[model samples]
Target chain A: MERLPAFELKRPTSLAQAIEWLAATPEARAIAGGTDLVPNLRDGIGAPPVLVDLSRVPGFDAYEIRTAGARIGAGVTLARLASDAGVAAALPAVSAAAASIAGPGHRSVATVGGNLCVDTRCVYYNQSEWWRKSNGYCLKHLGDTCHVAPTGTRCHAAYQGDLAPALIACGASVELAGPRGTRTIALEDLYRDDGLAHLALEPGELVVAVAVPAQPRGAMSAYRKARARGAIDFPLAGVAVRLAVDDGRIAAIDVALTGTNSRPFRLAGTAAWVGRAVDDGLLAELGKAVQKQVSPMRTTVTQSNWRRQVASVEAQRLVRDLAKVAS
Target chain B: MAKRVLSFVVNGRLREEAVGDSTLLLDLLREQLGLTGTKRGCDGGECGACTVIVDGRPQLSCLTLAARCDGAHVETVEALAAGGRMSALQAAFHEKLGTQCGFCTPGMIMAAEALLRGNPAPDEATIREALGGNLCRCTGYVKIIEAVQAAAAAGGGR
Candidate 1:
């Protein structure tokens, strides 16, 4: 294991205390679950001088089901989210996606907020600093041109998170707290369309919680993932679909795709294509439309063309399976 | 660098230690507490060799911060035996030839323990899914699955 460089760690017991510390120390970073931060630090990805450990902060780990939806604290581990009976029954797609993340160990330590705010990843950019420097530092870090798409001026790092796509499909919202105070926003607005500036979160802002709407009755959801390996591998392409049916007709549909772009791409037009009743042909057309919507660059574990193809196939399969249940 | 004082129970013993901020539970268990039963295969959480029971649930020690485990109860594979009597699952693994090279043994045992604690008798698919995170380069998981089945059949009462 690579040794982590020297840094100070502070454990705050309250949100106000944590905010005060962050406000005082400009270089300090808040760490709820270190599943993402520690690995990056050891890899020389990013090293802040001080780490504000938020695990001990009171009330930060509580998850509640309200009249509107479920409020998941930032410190709630992925394992808890996946295994919780309430979360599973209420939001099965989110739970299914959580269950399919890296592995049990990672799921036990990785938090929902961390996964949602995870750094945009690419085969070229997720490497050690030395490795990227040796390769002349692609557009994600220092250099000008995007190695993944040499002709394009933008970076093509994909948001390979399993939960974010599912959460977005469920119409979730998030709460953010920082030195400037707290604010709530739609989860869709948190991510930018560009890979270079993937998230719109400002410096010193910490994601506090995510609120997911209650699962409507007769709503069926599923997440399909394709990866090189069955266990402990990131998705080459993944699809999350949530459909609400009433009297054998589709009431609402949300389709979100991941591992194909910097941010989770919502197939709005494609979702609209399968409005009321979906047949095999309609599902196929929707898949084709989703394939056209996703512009995956050659930065994933699989080839870019293969990722796009798999995305189309998986999206079609997920929607078809969901429609079958609805029928 | 600042050090944090952590107090916790490990293997039926209460202990206190001062550790660095970045010290992972894997490092603390092996380097500081001298419990090497938890192996470190992939420090990146891909490999579950460092699995340990934290607050009654199996967690990857490699990814968990030692500080995060303060005030919690940790059970390692070392505590599985009672008065040198091996656990039924451990004996079943030995009888079934479930382990080879022994790198993934501790983690596999802990995972099995957690599985049995929650589900005393699991089907083939359930056992496979529970042990999916743990990688075994040798013995091909056939015997491991069989051993778990045998233990469950034997009532897994212990």
Candidate 2:
């Protein structure tokens, strides 16, 4: 059996104490569910000396449904988010994204914050220490050269979180608790294109919770992911579509694509369809238009062109699904 | 390395032991306590061979640290049978030929156990969705679904 390297574990029960502990210990990594961090630690990705378990922190698992929107604690399990009645009814795209994550067992243990802040994956990067050592390591692990893009000086690892696209489409923001204080950032601004330092969070800061504002009155939400295999795999390409229809016409639509670029990318062309009546024909053109924004490299096992095609397919399917909703 | 006492209820029994920071719940069940029913497949979360019920939910044991299970209630496949009797789900698995490799049985049973406990009369789609995490390579899941449905039809474990 593969074993994880030994480290110090701290279980802080309060949020303030957790913040204090994180602020004081620069060598400590805050772990919510450990679904991503633990495996990565074992696989030799950032092996912090201490792991601060955030699962026991008070109020970390609360899923409070507000009048205008829903506030999901960072530590809330993906399973809970997927199954919560209020979350499903209010934000179907969020629910769908949560449910579509890994599988039942993973969703049971994986958390929303972790998913939002999951490490970027490159075929060259996520491997055992032995495999990486034998292959001379990639730029993601401080190696001199990147296997994905040998000419590039920086890492080209792809960010493949399932929730960010949907959350960004719904106009979500994250509350972060850090040593300095608490600050909230629009979900779109929280991420950078760099996979090595993907998040814009300062050291010792943790994502406290994510807030998804209320769905607009004429809103229709849907999330779609295309995977090579049927189950238990990450999406090769994913699409999250949130459409607002008013007076029997499209008020607005926000389309975000995942797994295709370094960071979540929203289609600027969605503005063109602001006041247009969308049909299957317009959706087809929109799908192709959306595909133009994605530039998928050889990040995962799926070919770049294949993933681009999938992005188009997913976009078309999403727009068609949104068109089904009665305006 | 720091060592901490992990006190949790296992199989309806309160068990406490000092676990290291790197100790996974799978190691605790298979090595320390001698409940080796949960097989470790893809020690990463890819495979569901190490599934267990933690507080009425089926989660991966490999991904869970023992120290994190402090004061929690954990149910492994070990607890499914009592007094020389197999659980209804186990009996159904056997009667319906649910195992060929027999490696994923424990995890499958535990996942199905949690589902049946929550929803006694789950339909085929529900059963399949509940057991979606558990993968049986030898048996292509048809018989496993049948076994779970059979168990549900047979009152789904008293």
Candidate 3:
């Protein structure tokens, strides 16, 4: 067992206190559900001087269902998000994504905010300190060159989050709180394409909650994740689809993918379906379009070609599934 | 660094201990309190060997900060069974020959306990998904799933 190094732990009962504690130490990090961060700490990936435990913070664990939308607290565990009747009924895609992450033990404690801000992983970067030192570490850490691409200088670690793609597909926004104040930004804007500096959050800013607008009638969403194992492995290629067709024409359609790039974002060519009627051929074409867009490197669980193929298959299946709900 | 006292209820008993910053819940339970039934398979959260029920939810004790457990209730595998007799779930595992090496038994039972508490009757797919994080290399999952099924059939989880 890899032991976590020595550090100071602070449990903050209030959000204000948590923010104050985080701002107090520039090296301090807020941990809602330590599923991701704790393991990273034990892996010697980071050694923060102070760890502000946000698990006890009140009022950040509720899933508030408003008239038009819902506010999902960042502290809400993935298990709760996946199993909550309101969350499942309101946004099944979100529930599906949450459910697909890791397994029961992890989901029960891993929070939505943790999933949103989960670290970008790579084959060369996620190993133990000793393993990386022997493997001639990548640009993600002390080394300069990327093992995946010898010529590449930047870290192309794939973003391994399950919920971010689904949330982005649903046009969700997040409430960010910091020492200065609070502000809400579109979820898509929170991510930068770079794997190293993945989040756009300023220093001391923390994600408070995610706001998901209510899905209109006739709107349906779904998610598909391809992985090597049934349980704990991260997805090789994940595709989340959202679609709504009024009468016979497409009202809206958004597709987002993760584990295929450095950041999860809305899939391109979705505007081609704004007013179009989706046919089986068009669905296959959409799959092909998505396949062409993906250029997976040798950084994930599955092989590069297999990842591309799985992406195409999942995209097509996702569209076919969503089409069933819409029609 | 600062040390804080963690006061939490364990198996219906109030317990208190002072812990440092990076003291894991596993360390608190096994080292501070000498509750070693919870195995440490992977100090990383990948393996479900260190799972303990915290406030009616199953969480990996290895990654849980002991200081964060303030004012909470935790249940370990030792809480099950009375006297020397095994609990129904434990007996079901024994009867079904669920353990080949017995390494994953405690964590598996704890996880199943949480599952059965919430859902007394989970189907095969549900049971499989629920225990997916728990890896067993010896007997495989056929007998383990069968044990859970047998427990559910005997109305054991509730």
Candidate 4:
């Protein structure tokens, strides 16, 4: 069994204490649920000199439904998000995406904040340190050349986060607390589109909470994910579609695709293709345009070409399902 | 490493202990409390081999930190056997041939216990979805699903 490397662990009872500890120990890393970090540490992927356990942090494990929007704490587990009736009713796309992540056990331990802050993954990058050393470290870890794309100048690691696309589609924003006071940013602003430097979060900053806007009236949303298996596998290509209908016509549409690129890609152009059109042909054309817009690199579990094809199919399925439910 | 003190009720008994920060609930049950029925198969949450009921919900002990269960109530597979006899679900498992190697039996039972606690009567689809996380290379899940349905029909371990 792989064991965590030697390190000091500190449990803080409040978010203030956690921030103080993080500021005090420059070598420390904050751990909320440890669903993502613990495995990385045990596998010798990345180990900090100190771990600041955030499980004891008060006010960080709750979900609050305000009149304007819903606020989910950083420590809120996936299971909590999946089972929250208010969240399910208000943000069905987010709830459905959470329910589709891993299994019950994993959902119980994995936190929404952790899932959002999860490291970029690729077939060659997620391997153990020893395995990487034996196979020569790729661009993501040690070496310079990306194994997936040899001619590429930078790392081409894929981001497989399940909730980001849905959250983005729902027009959610995230709060971050660091050495500098707190700041709120649009969820889409957190990603940099670069595989190597995927997130815009600073080194010592912690994601405090996420706020999801309430669904508009006459709006319908759905998430479709394609994976190797029905359960427990990361999405090969997933689509989250949110549609606002006006007098039985599409008023506005928001479409985002995951596991198809380094970060979540918004199919805004494809949304324009299906605007005000409630027919099957328009929906089919929108799906094909979405597939064309998503340039899935060859780093995921599925073949690049196949994943791209499924992205198109899944997008079409999502639109069709939403139209069916709307009508 | 600093050790944290954890206080919780386990199977109708209150227990307290000082454990390491990284001590998993599965280790606390098997090593400290001597409740060995909760087997540990995969330390990761992928396998349901270390499932236990925490605060009325089924959770993977291997993925749960011991300190996280403070002030929570936990029920293990051993708690199901009362008066030195098997519960109805256990009996159904035996009658329906739910176990082949028996390595995954304890976790499966605990998961089923949580399922029945939430929903006294679950259909075949619900049963399968509840036990989807629990993998059984043996039995092919047919007998296990049948056993759960039979237990549900019998009012869930009554």
Candidate 5:
């Protein structure tokens, strides 16, 4: 049976103490839910000397939905968010994204922050310790060579997080606490293009909470993903769309995608097409833009080309479906 | 690693023990406490074989640290029967031929037990959603779903 390596666990009473513990131990990693980190630890992927348990941290469990928007705590469980009617009514995309993660058991313990900070995964990198050792590892871990690209210097592991794209599409921002202080950044800016150093957080910085600003009136959003199975599988490709139509024309639209590249990004071409009519030609053009922008590599077991095409199609379908529902 | 005094209730019995920081709840249940009913299929969160009810929620015991469940009420498969008689869900599984090899039965039952407690009259779709994390090699899930439905029909879900 696989086992976790030895490490000291510290349960801090406050966010400040958690930050202190992290700063004190450079190898320490904050654990909100062990849903993701624990498995990686068993695979011998990362060996942090200390695990700061954030469950005891006060003020990190709040889940509020207001007219302005929502303030979701880092410690809010995915199950709770998925089951909440208010979250479903207000931010259906976020709720659906939460509901679509792993399964019921995983959702019970998995947290909002953990899903947002889920590690970039690859077929080569997510193997067992024995398998990784036999393969001599890869550029993402102890090894020097990149098996995916062979000659590439950087790790091409894909960031397959489900929550980020939905949150980013809804114009969310993250509140971060660190040894330095507290600050907020647009959720899209929280990530970088590098899979190895994907999160733009500094050492000892922790994602304290996520703040989602209110959407425009009469807007609707939803998220969808394609995977190998009906459940318990990571997304091969996922898309989230927020659309507000005024007089049967696009008044506002935001689209974001995951499982394509090293970072979940807002589609950069949406702003120019805001006022265009939602038609078959416009949807075809949107699909082409998606296919052109997304760069999926050999990260998942699914074919990269298939994933890219699926992303484009899913994006177009979501836009058309949401527009139909609104009209 | 620092050892902390842990206290929790298991199957309506309270126990206290010193646990290392890294001691998983699965190990504590199977090794230290001698409750081997919770099978460790993947030893990771991928498989639902090591599932148990922690604080009325079905959670992957292998993914949970024993220290994290300090004051929680935990229920395992051993608590299902009373007076050596199989509970309604267990009997439904036994009579409905839900167990082909029986390795994944305990976890499946525990997950169903949690679901029944929350939603006594779950439909077929709800049953599938609740057991989504559990993988069955045999019976093709038809009998398992039938077993859960039968148990709910017998008033055991309450």
Candidate 6:
């Protein structure tokens, strides 16, 4: 059994207090759910001198559904997101993505913020400390060179989180609080392409909540992923599709993908599909576009080409399904 | 940074003990309280061997901090037996041959207990989803599913 390294755990009663604590201690890491952070800590991935647990922060667990959209607190558990009636009604893709993550016990404790901020993974990077030492640590952590792309300078670890793609597909934005006070940013912009430094958050900054904008009338969305098992495994390649049909034609469509690269991104050329009818020819072209845009590295144990194919296949299937319902 | 005295109720008994800040709930339950029913398998969230009911929710004890459980109600496999008699869920697991190696039974039962409490008559798909976190290396999960179904059939879900 791997043991977590010792650190001071501070429980803050308010979001302001949590921000202050983080600002005061630069080495402090904010912990929500601790599902990913705990295991990473045990595996010697990080050694933060202090931990600010976010569970005690008031209003952090609040879930509100508005006419515009929904404001989901950072502390809201994945279970709640999956089971919440309003969330299911308004943002079905978000709920489906949350429900697909890990398993029931994990979903009970895993938070939206935690899943959004989950670390990028690579076969060489995520391992026991002893195993890493024996194999020579990767560039994402202590090592100088990346095992995935030995010649390349950039870390190739893949971001396998399921929520980012779904949320990004829905055009969500996140409210972040830091020493500079609070500001909102597009969820897509919150991530960078670098696996070693995936998040664009400033030092001591914390994600407060995610705000999902209102969906268009007649809109339908869904999220799906390929994994080794039915549960308890990260997505090999996850896809989220949101589309609306008006008068028997595709009015709008958004496609986002994860587990294929360092950052989850809304496919750029999806707008080209607008006004087109859902058919076998359109689906084939969509699949080709997806496969062309997504570049899967050798971060996972599975074949990178297989993941790329899976991502395209999933996107086409989801788009087809949602378009059928919308029309 | 320093150890603090934490108070929490386990199996209907209140306990106050000094624990390290880094101490895991699995360690606190198995080591300090001597409640070995919560087995430590992977010691990581990947395996649900240390699953426990906390405030009516099934959580992985290995990933939970002991300090976080303060003032909370926790239920382990030990609480299911009354007067040396196995609870209906436990009895179902026993009678249905759910345990081959018996290592994952405690977690399986605890997870099922939480599920049944929430949805008394969960269908086969629901049971599989609820127990998805728990891994049983011994059996092919046929008997485990049967055990949970049998318990629900016998009105044990209440």
DockQ of 6: 0.81
Winning model by lDDT: 5
Compute the lDDT of residue B154 as modeled in candidate 4. Answer: 74
Local accuracy of candidate 6 as per-residue lDDT tens digits, A102-203: 988889989999999999999998899999989989899899999888999999899999999999999999999998989999999999999999999998
In model 1, residue pairs whose N, Cα or C atoms come closer than 3 Å (at least 3 residues apart or on different chains), thus clashing, are: none
Interface DockQ per candidate: 0.57, 0.72, 0.79, 0.45, 0.81, 0.81
Clashing pairs for model 4 are: none
- C-alpha RMSD by candidate, in order: 2.2, 1.5, 1.6, 2.4, 1.0, 1.0
TM-score of each: 0.93, 0.97, 0.96, 0.92, 0.99, 0.98
* lDDT by residue (tens digit), candidate 5, A137-253: 998999997788888888888999999999999999999999899999999999998878899998999998999988899999999999998778788899999999999989999
- Report lDDT per candidate: 0.83, 0.86, 0.86, 0.82, 0.92, 0.92
What tens digits encode model 2's per-residue C-alpha lDDT throughout A1-327?
A: 358788888888888888887777787888887887878887887668778888889889887886599899998999899999888778888999999888787888789999999888888888888888889988889587888789987777888889999999998999998888899999988888786788899988899999988888778788989886566667788999998877767887998888987788677778888887888767877877877888788888889999999899888887777877654
lDDT of 1 by residue, B80-155 (tens): 8888888888888888998889899899889888889889999998888788889999989999999999888887
What local lDDT score does residue A31 receive in model 3, on the 0 to 100 scale? Answer: 88
Question: Over the full model, what C-alpha lDDT does candidate 6 score relative to the true structure?
Answer: 0.92
DockQ of 5: 0.81
Count clashing residue pairs per candidate: 0, 0, 0, 0, 0, 0
Deviation in Å, model 5, residue A109 alpha carbon:
0.7
Cα lDDT of model 4 by residue, A3-58, tens digit: 55667677788777888888887878888767667666766776677788888888
| TM-score of model number 6 | 0.98
Docking tier of model 5: it is high
Against the true structure, candidate 2 reaches a TM-score of 0.97
